[model samples]
Target: MSDEKKLPLRTAFAVSVSKTAAALSRATGRGDGSVIGGRLGMMIDPDLLAHLAAGREIALVSGTNGKTTTTRFTAAALGVLGDVATNSFGANMPTGHTSALARAGATRYAVLEVDEHYLAQVIQATEPRVVALLNLSRDQLDRAKEVAMMADLWRQALAAHPKVHIVANADDPMVVYAAGAHPADEVTWFSAGQRWQDDSHVCPACGGHIQRGEAGGWACANGDLRRPSPQWTLLDGEVVAPDGVPHEVKLQLPGTVNLGNAATALAVAAKFGVNPIDAIPRLGSVASVAGRYAQVERDGRLVRLLLAKNPASWLEAFEMADVAPTLLAINARDPDGLDTSWLYDVDFSPLRGRQVLVSGDRAMDLAVRLEINGVPFTHVKTFADAVAAVPQGRLEVIANYTAFQDIRAELDRVL
Candidate 1:
């Protein structure tokens, strides 16, 4: 329970204005209205987010990847207890948090998807009951902090808020280092496996080599930093809860990465006093978050949309996608980070035998990378072209941030 206070007159006015602006934005077909609404509200009252988060139980999910889906899962799992207000769309900054809280007035619980860079700021404002750290990796490096720097920010934030319980990944060294800032009892560890270890070869504590054990563990060669023993562990499609109870996880979302997210969500739900048995079923209820894994029918072909912003996420996307012809869209927009150089960081070898169709503003960059990786690809202009190039069947379309929105827009318009 939180000491939620009555909103001040000014803040109430700001909230009202924000909701109106967001509704108008949607009504006018400007956008989803989440960002516009929150921006207007925050402009009216700069401290609008803190003011709204004053009296509710908050859980924040932050990481380089999977934060959005993990936040969705945490919110759904929390549904077993009561209604949870969350930013269902990918608008995951201060403005988005303000809009979500303002829109869902009087909700007792909120599970927010906080951008990795803004994790500290959100923690300071919301004073969340539980902060779930999924995994720290290289993402949007041109706009965001480096992996170690982001981990340090998380460390400082957790240290400042000692009372906030932490549900963090033990497999990721950087996540372990950050979550270690909290005292033992205040932290809950989840052995959600990290598949992309490109950014965490060196220990964050010291520049020592991180030695990984075959039995799922890691330690710094010359420092005390090591993988924590997780209370909740994900084994072959099942989660073993803290009480040593094993519950099989069956999710509508694809891939083993989502299974790890399910484990992390269950851990966060447990901190809020939700039973894994009662909440596990709710986890299955979420088929997609935002438009990440949504399958839309275009030209009699079932096209699945998967978003991969960086190398780490691209790896997971490859695993989730089918072996059929795949469309890879890239963009260097502000939201997608103005660097396609990260494409070099992704191993495109998985699409070697499969048909790969490249599109978007950075299609040439993606094509060159695929060529270097010895993968064959055909360049296309639009989503319709990509669909036409393939036969009438399942086609997987993977894209970065803004390009994904573009395809989704075209998808809606064409349908």
Candidate 2:
């Protein structure tokens, strides 16, 4: 590391101390964004960035899915403009984000993926220049009130922020509504031109009906508009044409769900006056976002990690797999996970041909559902157990946000 990049030991120590204390505070009871984000808030609330003008910028990516992907893409695109600091490890709350800033020493920009529930607190504390709200869905039923209920909370939170420039998914009625009503300094909409929409949940604004169009993308029957056909859409080809990564499609990641995510990131950049072509190259540079559809090579076998804790995420994971030969699942509890009720809601019929292994704390729950769904399975009681039983070929593992650490850690150890 360069001398300029090196931070003072005492400063780092102090930041660590504060983070430790804050994390401990939330070690018990139901922890909200109150402590997780507040710790970093104490570090660099608004006052601390006063003198820094290397065109310092902070960007926030929040929503149910693609927050991490959007955060990475935004950071990558902004990195083209200047030096960037980001929390790619998902420490997106205020405190964790602050810790990243502290570690970065001096940086021109900061990109973070803030959680949906904590959006208000994170924004109130960090004051990002741009806030991207990805499509919301049914996630964490145990903790979150309801998908629509949380959507209302999201609207309220975004409405409170006035200075931040916002980018929203126009295809999602809820997201569009939030963006359209945001009191931000400025707002822009981004869409995939009516492709890859997950709008099956219907419009959260008007009681209008939403339908899956012939193209399989979601559309509202009402005049509620989409981002006017995004100026930047991912060209389809086998991974090499749209730009060059090499595959059957112009995707660095899997699933049409992620194609929408990629499109959203590009649109957000274009909305910021960034040329879509100029930023498209950056997308090629970043492909596998951790815990999303992160494909890792273990020996010669491909093990794709599908981070699917929510109903929509599970749906996306299954869609992307295309019924792989073997599938594995992990659902361990850690990093504040919730009970698994949304599992019963996921559609698993396409998985009939694939052999499956389910693990995690809720492995039995998923296995039972799989059995009822008629998905043939192999036996594995835990991630460790699954590791012993994994076949040597293309494999898929869908894990919750919390199980990511445990499952990935064990995979590294044994796979």
Candidate 3:
């Protein structure tokens, strides 16, 4: 450890404290203390800063939604040219940085996906070269504060870096406005061009009117619109090379939202010089993003797990259901599914004719929400009861982060 580096005394001490804490968590099976991977960065911040000073470059992606898939796609797209590093597994915090650091180890280039709240904190400490702004939506209301609060924090993140490239989503008024003040080369707008229409109206930047175009892209009357020529375009439900290679991605988990996530991944990954067209074949190969649209099949029946961590995602997932399927919605303890306020924000009328099985720590709360909305559902306290309640048709299990794990455990038994 002494020969590791010429680390400052404070950094060395912090590293030791982090290592000890990590060890205790592992020994007690409480945690590796690296959920978001932040603690390790508290120690390694000095090292990451030194790397930046030495002229190394960094590519980072952060947003309220779609980070995991984007991170994975970015790494794959970039990995074509050289070795790449990323938090594809949701390790976007400091201790997660330690894990990333362990793998990246002089890889020279990195494309990391991080939490919106932690983005500014890490960018200030690490000074990454490119910061991809995917979009902002109402997600994780319990922990992330608000979408506007995140946008404000983003401005502070931009200030710390001399060179910041924002790959903004043209459909998101909030993201497009963040690009208006920045240079054209420094800012590029990405949109799916009619594939996905964002629900957010009103300009997050100017309080001006937002109008939708023929291709489903948005713009302001004052010319605050998605630029025509972007470094990357989220067009046609997948990423495409200008030559029409059709990075032909196919995500079987269902929903246009997964398609949107692919589009964002394509835009950011292309910027890092990965051939999007080549990666399309592999998107379907990733069957489950570990409960976030992850799929599992058992006993001649299939259970597609859609981790609806918030209202926006929940609504999108509900809209994505196919063939009038049976659904199971669970409310768990994670901040991902807390503050069911977003429940009232959505229209549950589509669920009127469908049978919904509700379960989780707060299953009664969600069940009540469904009842008030007149959506047909059965409330169950245990996963077994919920599984038994639903008929064995094409079952869609949409759970909050933690409940996803719970339902997935039972899926093994009854699917």
Candidate 4:
């Protein structure tokens, strides 16, 4: 029903082939098929994304963490408008993005979760109407640039594309510096409250020490940098709008972190003409994002999946864990980040005084960290073994990237 332009003959052929490849890939159970389809499309036409995204309203979500969840929330909130095509399976890169758009059909709106490193390329190709900059921290050190370098890249990208309206997290110094690079009028700031300040101690502007005050207040030693007065603020578990009205947000997902994600999504939704009251309830209806907070029943046991990829996310995940039996899985796969040194950065103190089941390829490494933290843990060889070790009641399972996917796949096989 969209008035969007039709694809060129060659590009249309590429899309058909890609869709057929994706169908075959899904039927064969080789994986999600997003990557294969997108790869083949790109092989046929390097500009496949531009063709697919033509005449559509695009919104891009980018950050070090929470991009997947925030993209889901933003898409759900925008659903009040109409059909929103999104890469909900966590395929955020160019190939996956191409696949998502290629299959979007007549959908006129898209909410895309973009990799932080590829934000500039995607923005240039799609010419998104709104861009959500969540937060920045060290992630995938082996594959990603340094935090400062990423900030600089974002600054340059925003400066180059001044027409794109930006919704950025003001609480994060790196995000502040990056988004602040654009014309101030083009940016709308939101403070979701930073729980992990260990990585943001130094001011990105002046390299001076950053100060954190009580109740999410922060200032920099140098006068050049400080937390901006956010247009949207999450105060006391509610999102406060510019009109000084508080909209209570209840999420099926757990943790204060999800509250922050909701606030960010609301800001983006408002930019797209959705009222905060309408968008807030739509965001709260999101039960789970991808497999992040999914409650799966396997072998007569309820296992809740929680994902944390870095120290910042891990700190938040630990806060959300219940006192019930817990399973911690860590992997050093390419997707999970090979450098396990970040394990030491997390305060595993909450895990103390509880019997923790540690499993994954890097279980022993986590065991050593837990031992030093004085957390009682048993290192299991397999995810099934770890699940079996937990008592037969409500259980919590937290894992890094690859481990989380493997556990979900294994559960799907049996359940």
Candidate 5:
């Protein structure tokens, strides 16, 4: 109400109308309405997002993978200061950001998940206090920009906003090159171990081979490009702060990838003046992120959901998955990237010893890839069939974007 008084009359009306539209969208069972509402609000007032973000203590989380989960972590850590508004869902675009800020109305702190490609646009609008650069990899090749291009965009954005502190992953060469655009004092580097080397083998600064060290450091074979020594590091479930104080990472999300995410969150929280030791418990409280690692009961069997959008995320998901009956779902829909060719880049060997079932709109494509990889799998027609095809005690489901949403909806209906 106090903030509304500061808004121009037309912008205030646009906010009200967008809220009504969002509520109607929810009533009609369309979706969460975050995107639609924000779209409408921006249509009325083109600068609605910038206006809403003007005075907030904002921190943005962006990357090819783990944006949603990392944003959740940052919000929870910042919750130590006050009520932190965030996009809990996977909506990371301008429209989603607009809706979130509009709904949260006057929250002092806001942590927003930003899509990798839209990082520059969001940085300009939010002018956040801190920006967390997670990692870069080949994701949605048909739709999104290449990793190098994204890194370049980030570099330009950071160069323009020298005042904003950058919390960067030092293990990722792409991240290092991009965040290196800022002055060293303004950037806080954290090494959490980058699992996917498929995208970062080449030096972003020069056309050279990036030689990765056995200890997780790297250097350019042709030039001076190399991994920066991190102020924060996540090594074997322990997060070491800049002062060399190590805090044990106790996370419910499962796997080292989530631990890496926790490290990034802690660094961002530290920039916001929250003690890293105090934020550990808040990070542990995040059990599931937008249905990524949720375990649901189906016919007395626990079904765990793990979302993997690209090869990089799939590798992490495989590590988090248990040695149980695993269901792999792939969709070539727009949201899931119409090209299913990225499946070739992923090594599905982890599921070789377990009973595997494949299902989705692109089940045939997935089956062919599995066949080529010598990974045995059964092709099922529907989610129910996939569930019944394997002996049910504990089942792990991995799906990309839209397919993941579909499975979650089906689980809601069935159980």
Candidate 6:
């Protein structure tokens, strides 16, 4: 890793080219240009991330779900201390990391939402001050590493970086195993409330079934794994601190899931010396994070955009779709992961009695799932067509990765 102050001529040239590419991408309406630019930059300079992140304090946020929202919240919370550099658009790869740091100029603090697989490399390069480990679950099994494999990777990575402080979720057994390498005092555990425990039923240590007990406690049948005492717990939508003081957390985002996200972010913020009382208000200010819960008016229809890439995320999104006339979209693009089979894991039975309109390149796939679940659905060929189908009232538009972005982009043009 070369000093960023005196970056080599090639690395500097790569940065310039990457920035120009990103600008051109945005101008042409291709995309946000964050991923492409970062991709191009990393190609030229293999160590571009290390170079740009030199001499900066970093807080790496990683997990199966809620990484993007948590990253946004943590970055905003850290703003109380100083300007923070972050990959705001949910790009959690090396290229994205390079692009963010390259554009950040002289920012001292970086809060990055890192992919579970890339945690080791990013941590080695940036040497983050704190690492926030959210819940781990099976996501994109066809493309992503298995839950146990990812846990092992995290355990090995965190074991090597023992100096880094850890903010981990105590309720998740996988997260507990991953952060177990760190000493008790070095880790700050938070019970964020896990609703989807199907993937985490087995203990990562002895392969024994994890048993859940009262008060959000869990222990393995083999006595190898158990939940740790959490410093922060989300109790009935309120965030309780280590002192047994509960703070009411209000967020512009909907669902108990966002409340959990806020809890984890608040835990990280407190470790950075941000007052929870002050940060709670700041967390609420985040109405929508990259179109997660954004409402847009298009053609006289109020459409709320929600993103659910994996089954766990879908479970959360489905819980929030209590409104009528919903638009469900699914895509299997690179960003969304090529495997659409995870759709079957989501219980779409809740949408059984509603008027469900489906759209996306994989609309038929979702249509089939809805039909099997006994939910009547119509497959619209395009997002616009689906939006047009919802004649009036609030239309709940829930989509997977790329579909969410496409719908959000289309609505942004009209709204």
Candidate 6 C-alpha lDDT tens digits along 1-415:
4576655776798899889999998899987788898889888888788888888888999999999999999998888889999999888988888888887877989999999999999999888899999989988787789999899999999999889999999989999999997988889999878878888888889999999999888999999999998988877779998889999988888888888888899889888888889788889899888777888777888788888888888889887765678988888998788888888888988777778998898888887888788888888888788877877878898888888878877777322
Better TM-score candidate (1, 6): 1
Put down candidate 3 lDDT per residue, 1-415, tens digits, no spaces: 4665666565545545555665666678664455423455454554643342234466778876677766776666666667776655576764576545443446767777777777777676556777777767777666666666667677666755647777776666666555556666776566643322343465556656777766555576666544445544545565654465555567765676777667666666666666666656555666555456655554434656676676666676776676444555555466554577766776777778777777777777777788899887776677556555666656677777777766666665222
Q: How would you encode candidate 1's per-residue C-alpha lDDT over 146-184 as one tens digit per residue?
A: 899999988998899999999999999999999887889
Tens-place lDDT digits, model 2, residues 1-415: 3453343443445555555655565565334223454355355433222222124577778887778877887777776677777777676655566655654557877777887888877776666778887777766656665666767787787778776788776566667666767653376555533322344356667656776564425556785633333333445522221233333225567767666666666655555556555666777677667555666666555777777767767767777774665445546364434566666677777778776776666677878888888888776766545544656677777777666656677665222
Better of 1 and 3 by lDDT: 1
Off by over 4 Å in 6: 1-13, 413-415
TM-score of decoy 6: 0.94
- Report the Cα lDDT for candidate 2: 0.63
- What's the true lDDT of residue 83 in model 6? 92
Using all chains and alpha carbons, the TM-scores for the candidates as numbered come to 0.96, 0.77, 0.82, 0.95, 0.96, 0.94
Off by over 4 Å in 2: 1-55, 183-185, 192-203, 206-251, 291-300, 332-337, 382-390, 413-415
Candidate 4 lDDT by residue in tens digits, 114-187:
99999989988889999999999988888889898899898988788999999999899889899877888888
lDDT of 5 by residue, 232-314 (tens): 88766798889999899888898888888888999999998999878889999888888889989887678999999999999
Looking at candidate 6, the ten consecutive residues that score lowest on lDDT are 406-415
Q: Which residue segments of model 3 deviate by more than 4 Å?
A: 1-5, 8-33, 36-57, 159-162, 193-200, 221-231, 234-238, 242-247, 298-300, 332-334, 408-415
| Ten contiguous residues with the weakest lDDT in model 3 | 192-201
